[model samples]
Target: MSQNWKFFKESVRHFWQVGSLVQSSRYLVDSLLADVDFAESRLIVEFGAGNGCVTRELLRRMRPDARLFSFELSQVFHEEISSIAARDPRLTAVHGCAMLAAQMFAAQSVDCVVSGLPMGNFGKCAKLGVLSTVHAVLKPGGHFSQFQYSLLDYRLMKRHFPAVRLGYTPLNFPPAFVYNCVSA
Candidate 1:
């Protein structure tokens, strides 16, 4: 009962600040996968997989040998992810900060990184730390994709990646811009 309340409140709090917005038609789970090519990836990592929305899609598209590691902070959301994590050997639910990604994953090990984290909520230091860690874990040609409410960081993505591609999903409530980045 208390757990449910915690989930509800946390969802509400972060939703307004950063949670999945149905009005914007943005459900972190599904939208993130619309453009992914699962055949090109075997080891996938997800940053800030809230409510396993995109997580589930990754699992669904994965090859039989594929593995998924998702990082989530909220205990409530963590628990939600764990519910499915335990059922699938391919899914590893990591309860920790996104900044620790490189430590948790082997160097140059990930093929694709899909983040649901709201960079808008974090400071510049945090964005750099987390993105650096992402660069550390990504293979030389690995891709990084993240969505934001605005186009404030296309240049930042360019600095971090060799190439950056932009796409928009107006279906999401308030609309969203997806940044598709790859290591140079």
Candidate 2:
């Protein structure tokens, strides 16, 4: 399909940032959102919207009034997400870095932050900056769900979040570990 092609091409071009050559499997997306209460979460932020697979799923599940700000650094992926945002009033596709989340939104304004970023590929400063920004925007008790090919940034996440729960999904392109961390 066209989706697969775009994902593959983009991944090949930006492997370190995009992470995978295929879009996330439905199983992986479900596992990442399993603990999130979409109905109760009014404001959501998605880091590394990539090809918009997870963004579409979040739009489908979130409440009518819920708002989704999907941040994508890649131009191709950002355009893809922007097109989807054009059709969905609730989605705000942002072409920027995840580390700037705090600048884009008010502190304690987000109910949750979901990410498909390749944290393992990020340098320590980038990892910490993004995590801290995510934490700053999230409301108390808000959740941050991120999936990675490995537990590369597990310790970093634990340092920023008060509680971090880990899970795994074997049905993805490459099986992934999902971290569900809650802001204190």
Candidate 3:
């Protein structure tokens, strides 16, 4: 919780630009990856992919035909994702709000959406906007994966996804829960 200034500033910059927080621990990385059901996916999108940490991991784990569309608002992080995106045909980093997920992406087009944004950080209106868009973009049987700092959003999550499972990661700084927000 008591993060260094340099790292903290860098994280804020990346997040202000990209919409995600930085995770310094390798254990956090492993936990995020383990919860993802990548084997059945072809179209993958990441919301709030800051600095491309999870995006890079998604690239490494995804199948050959899978395409990744990463949405980050921060220009700094967008440039970072773009720099790497150019090297691979499967990747694309879009500078936009995840709240516009429906219009930005074709309806029911995504097979999986892995979110890194802190949904709890948003206001009720803004939070609902992003959730609605997420629901519209995912195909039936598609999974919307996200991790949270606590189980505070459990009720709303169940309303959004057909199935929602809670798992703990004490290894994460301050400890966190990975919510597999699966759609009906």
Candidate 4:
């Protein structure tokens, strides 16, 4: 099946969660990952692995022994990404919510977290839970990158991460705001 079709179908079925009708573009991916140091990262987590665009990029840059766990709440998206994960030993696909990150990974165990989750769509409590889980799993100096079409979650991100750097990319389907954050 064509990847684009899959994205369209999933987006129609889960618009509020998926956020877009297509996968992220290279420009948006690059912008979101501008500050990630993949060379030294060993344990990484991806919040939403919709069609594996960013997952492929992360795998390309990550070391041979590095492990990447990708979470997707939509069963369809999970199945799609799981197929991609099957081809790479370093990648693991989890069909669950990002809020379970703290339960899945030990405190300060993750080197980085790249999120495709729509934080702006989440309620305040859900937002706080997910952000807190991200903070709990990330190492003291680790990074978390999240991209959204709006700055609706800017203050929410700042509340959890001590340092937050914002970047914009107009090349995507809808211009995106990339937040590069560091855990204190």
Candidate 5:
């Protein structure tokens, strides 16, 4: 199945987890990753990597020696990422939760985190848990980029990161607001 079809199917069956019925547009993907300096980044983590859309772009832009660990909660999407991983040695497809990031990697070891998680659908505690995990795993000056359909999590993101920059891409299916946060 095509990536879009797979994403739509998963979103229909698991809206709370999958978040969107459509894959991210190139504009949104670019906007979300604009702040990441791929050349300087060594270890990158991607959360909620749906259908490997952003994963593919990240791989394309990253340094050859850099590593990406993509975490997906959905089995179907994880399989798709795993297939991509098979071809790219720098990619590691992890079928798990983003909250487990700290446990999977050393503290302050990740250079960047690009997340497509539907934080708008998560409860307060769950959002805090995931954000805390991102902060914990990120290096002192690491970047954390996430896209949301609304600005609901803007304040929450600011609370977690020392600095937060917002950008918007109206070309996406539902449009998206990108939050590029810098870890302290």
Candidate 6:
């Protein structure tokens, strides 16, 4: 089956985890990554990397030496990204939860984190847990970029990052608000 078909099927079956019925648009992906300093980002992590859409884009923009660790909870999506990783030496496809990020990497070691996680679908504690993991793994001035269909997580992000900037991409299926946060 095609990637979109797989994504649609998975989203329908696991809306709360997958978040959207389709993969993000290029416009939305670009907006989500707009603030990343690709040149300076040597180690990057991507959460909720569905079907390697954003993963491919990240690989395209990253420096030849940069590394990306993509985490996906779904077996189907993880398999898809694993295939991409087989072709790209710089990518590591992780079949696990985003909350395990800190365990996988050293504290204050990651340069950036691009998240497509459905924070709005999670309860307050789950949200805080994931945010804390991201914060802990990120360098002092590392970037944390996330996107949500709604603005519900804006204040939550602000609480985690000292600096948070919001951007919009109306071209996506349901549109999305991108939060570019800098870890303190």
Where is model 5 more than 4 Å wrong at Cα?
A: none
The TM-score, computed over Cα atoms with residue i paired to residue i, of candidate 5 is: 0.98
The sequence of per-residue lDDT tens digits that candidate 2 reaches over residues 27-58 is: 99998898788879999999999999899999
Candidate 6: which stretches are off by over 4 Å?
none
lDDT digits (tens) for residues 51-117 of candidate 1? 6767777898898899999999877778978998988889999988877788888899999899988
Local error of candidate 2 at residue 105 (angstroms): 0.8
lDDT of 2 at 118: 83
Model 1 / residue 119 / CA error / Å:
0.2
Residue 10 in candidate 5, Cα distance off native in Å: 1.1
Candidate 6 per-residue lDDT, tens place, 6-91, comes to 99999999888898999999999999899999989999999999998899999999999999999999998999999999999999
Per-residue lDDT for 1-184 in model 5, tens only?
Answer: 7878878999999998888889999999999999999989999999999999899999999999999999999999999999999999999999999888989999999999999999999999999999889978999989999999999999998888889999999999999999999999
Q: lDDT for each of the candidates? A: 0.78, 0.91, 0.76, 0.91, 0.94, 0.94
Clashes of each: 9, 0, 1, 0, 0, 0
RMSD of each: 3.2, 1.1, 3.4, 1.0, 0.7, 0.8
Whole-model lDDT, model 6: 0.94
Clashing pairs in 2: none
| TM-score preference between candidates 1 and 4, better one | 4
Superposed model 3: Cα runs more than 4 Å off: 1-7, 12-21
Off by more than 4 A, model 4: none
Residue 167 of model 3 has an lDDT of 68
lDDT of 4 by residue, 1-184 (tens): 8988989998999899898988999999998788988888999999988888999999998999999999999998888889988899899999999888899999999999999988878888888888889888999999999999999988878887899999999999988999999999
lDDT of 1: 0.78
Estimate TM-scores for all models.
0.87, 0.96, 0.86, 0.97, 0.98, 0.98
Clashes of 3: 1
Residue 42 in model 2: shift from native, Å?
Answer: 1.0
Using lDDT as the yardstick, the better of models 2 and 3 is: 2
The 10-residue segment of model 5 with minimum total lDDT is 1-10
